[model samples]
Target: MLHPEDVPTLREREHGRNLEGCCGPHGGTGPNLACPCGSLVATLLADCLGPWEVRLHPLRTWAHDPTGA
Candidate 1:
């Protein structure tokens, strides 16, 4: 269920990890996107491997856990 509207954003996030030697031996990018958007993109990349195997590691928003407990 990939959409043209999201392709650009997902691709941009992937490119963020193209730091050959600046970061790690194998640069890394995160799929810390919002809700279903991030999950979908990660699955698509993992299944297709068209660019990178997007790993889902979404950030915890205060809205979801205001107590932070």
Candidate 2:
């Protein structure tokens, strides 16, 4: 469990990453540009908590089953 103080709130500005490219890839304002430090922090958190798994929501299917008719 993360400590209350250690866990950053969305309202906090200090927890956000810098757009200046500190820890992220060089040039063209990479992936971290939008959130900056948040990416690194999130990576660390994911590592500590074990590998993260993401499930994509199903997309709409336009084709209907003709065999049923």
Candidate 3:
């Protein structure tokens, strides 16, 4: 049985596999594991050694809001 908290919220549609699998089988995206972002947020949180926070900055505007126009 898998724990609900042991899963990564970020998911990739293009990749046939989930983020959890990339980290390692049954590893549940640990901080020590290599994530798509190349960070170890998962492992730190899982081990309860420290808190993890990720901030995403929008680099570019690909689309415009049609409703605003």
Candidate 4:
């Protein structure tokens, strides 16, 4: 699980993707985060009853260093 602050490009998904919890989002249904280009990328679990974190989809993400370091 990744911190929401670690992924600044992801935004809350619309159309009920964040409607699985009472206080916040449970993130058990499916991807609830999208990229700047509007592509589903990860699931955000921030419900008041569970651990809060962002789970990224393995097939939808990768690591890179613009500095080539």
Candidate 5:
């Protein structure tokens, strides 16, 4: 799990693969041991991290997205 501060609370879709920071034992601050976004984590945690957050499909939603993505 990521330390509350470093977590973006949401992720954007990268089509097939979206590897952001690492959600490994050391978290995003350490070496990236695994991909932290998409179906991988969703299968493990039962919730797709990408779709759970604000989606970039809408331009009006950008400001509320907080990701600046």
Candidate 6:
């Protein structure tokens, strides 16, 4: 999981059915964010009553350590 601000490439889902929340997206319906290429990649949990975070789909995502650890 990562902060939404950390992953600026993700865009809000086109539809609202997956973005139900009190203040922001609840991300309960499934992946509520997409890549610039329109690929569903993560679920953004920004609901006021829940932990604010973005859960990336592992199978659909890649990790590159800039520090080369």
Best by lDDT: 6
Q: What's the lDDT for candidate 6? A: 0.89
lDDT: worst 10-residue window of model 6: 13-22
Return the TM-score for each candidate structure. 0.22, 0.15, 0.19, 0.86, 0.16, 0.83
Return whichever of 5 and 6 wins on lDDT: 6
Model 6: per-residue Cα lDDT at residue 24: 91
**TM-score quality measure for candidate 3:** 0.19
In model 6, state the lDDT of residue 62: 91
Off by over 4 Å in 4: none
Residue range with the least summed lDDT across 10 consecutive positions in model 5: 24-33
lDDT of each: 0.36, 0.28, 0.34, 0.87, 0.29, 0.89
- The lDDT ranking, best first, is 6, 4, 1, 3, 5, 2
Q: What is the clash count for each candidate, in the order shown?
A: 0, 2, 5, 0, 0, 0
Task: In angstroms, give how far residue 17 of model 5 lies from its true place.
Answer: 2.5
1-69 in candidate 2: lDDT tens per residue? Answer: 233234343121244433233342222222221123332222111223233221111231133588977
RMSD of each: 9.9, 15.5, 10.3, 1.4, 12.3, 2.2
**Which of 4 and 6 is ahead in lDDT?**
6
The TM-score obtained by model 1 is 0.22
Model 3 ranges off by over 4 Å: 1-30, 44-69
Q: What is the full ranking by TM-score, best candidate first?
A: 4, 6, 1, 3, 5, 2
lDDT of 1 by residue, 1-69 (tens): 343355455443334443233322132343323343443233223323234433433343223566878
Candidate 4 residue pairs in backbone clash: none
Please give the distance, in angstroms, between residue 60's alpha carbon in candidate 6 and its true position after superposition. 0.9
Across residues 23-43, which tens digit of lDDT does each residue of candidate 5 receive?
412122222222244422211
Tens digit per residue, CA lDDT, model 3, 1-69: 223345465333234232344233333443233345543333322223323332222331134698998
